[model samples]
Target: MQLLEERILKDGIVKPGNVLKVDSFLNHQMDIEFINELGKEFKRRFADAPITKILTIEASGIGIACLVAQYFHVPVVFAKKAQSLNLDGEMFTSKVESFTHKKVYDVILSKKFLGPEDHVLLIDDFLANGCALMGLIDIVNKSRATLEGAGIVIEKGFQEGGKKIRDMGVRLESLAIVDSMTDDSLTFRPNN
Candidate 1:
């Protein structure tokens, strides 16, 4: 996690409207070797959990989830922002509002991939207002699956998402928590 914090300080860009652009290495253009280190850290963090599947939202979270799943040796299931022709059968759905995009989407997941028998670990690139993760949690609840925990690469600690999720009794782990950010500076909450 210290490594991730260092990377953010080195490469992350702070934009107006509370956006921290990590696209250069974390999301848009990825660093697999770096992500693999993150994956190893996640595995170490949740090593005792009986994780059967890693669930994440589509787009940004997918790649990180896939990398993390390799360590867990589990399949990655992502909630699609929209329904598509390739999807079929009964589905669990929830509405999510994107903090960055300023839009709402009805996220959906196939019921066949999740159920009461499996344990799920939610993965994502960032946690802002918690809407996306809330949507995924709704889908998991609908499927009656056990929610093991959530692994987030970066969490905007200045925002309410992390607290809200933790208050709901979910185990949330964030590799780098930016306590505050400005155009010229960024601060991180120390992990202890």
Candidate 2:
């Protein structure tokens, strides 16, 4: 996690409207080796949990979730932002509002992938207001899967998402929690 904090300090860009652009490394143009390190850390953090599947939202989270799933030796299930023709049968659906896109989407996943017998670990690139994550949690609830925990690469600690998720009794691990952010500077909450 220290490594991730250092990387954020070095490469993370602070934009107006509380956006932290980590596209150059974390999301857009990924550094596989670096992200692989993250996968290892997540495995170590959640080593005790009986994780059967790794769930994540589509787009930015897919790559990270795949990498992390390798360590868990589990399949990665992502919620699609849009309905596709390839999808069939009963599906779990939830509404999520994107903090970055400023829009809402109906995220969907097939029932064949998740069920009451499995334990799920949620993974994502970032957690802002908790909407996207909340949507995923809803789907997990609908599936009746045991929610083990969540592994987030970065969290806006200054925002309400982290507290909200924790308040709900969900085990949330965020590698880098940015407590404060500005155009010229940023501060991270101390992690032990």
Candidate 3:
């Protein structure tokens, strides 16, 4: 986690509108080694949980989730932002708002991948307003799958997302939680 925080400080860019762009390493153009380190850390954090599968939203979350799945020895299931012809079965659907994109999407996942017998660990690139995570949680509940926890790469601690998720009684693990960020400086939550 320290590695992640240091990387953020060195490479992350602070944009206007409270945006922290980590395109260099965390999300857009990925650092495989660093992502693998994150996967290891996530595994360590949720070591006690019986994680049967890793659930994530498509796009940014897929890469990190796949790496994390390798450590958990589980398959990664991502909710698609757009419905495709290839998908033709009963599906769980939920509406999610993107903090970065500033749009809402109907995320969907096949019912075959998740069920009551399995325990799920949700993974994502970032958590700001909790919309995406909440959508994934909705799908998990619809499928009757056990929600183990969520592993986030970066969490904006100034935002209410973390608190909302925690209030719902879902365990959340974040690699680096930024309590505050500006164009010139960034501060992380103490004891993260």
Q: Tell me each candidate's TM-score.
A: 0.99, 0.98, 0.98
| Candidate 1 segments exceeding 4 Å error | none
- 83: Cα error in model 3, Å: 1.6
lDDT of 1 by residue, 1-192 (tens): 789989999999998899999999989999999999999999999999999999999899999999989999999999999988898899999999988888989999998999999999999999999999999999999999999999999999999999999999999999999999999999999896
Candidate 3 per-residue C-alpha lDDT over 1-192 given as tens digits, one digit per residue, 9 for 90 to 100: 899999999999999999999999978899998899999999999999999999999899999999989999999999999888998899999998888788989999999999999899999999999999999999999999999999999999999999999999999998889999889999998754
lDDT of 1 at 139: 91
Which rank order by lDDT, best down to worst? 2, 1, 3
Residues 1-192 of candidate 2 have per-residue lDDT tens digits of 899988998999988899999999989999999999999999999999999999999899999999999999999999999989998789999999988888989999999999999999999999999999999999999999999999999999999999999999999999999999999999999986
RMSD (CA, Å), candidate 1 to true, equals 0.6
Clashing pairs in 1: none
C-alpha RMSD of each candidate structure in angstroms:
0.6, 0.7, 0.8
Give the clashing pairs for model 3: none
Q: Report every candidate's CA lDDT.
A: 0.95, 0.95, 0.94
lDDT of 2 at 167: 100
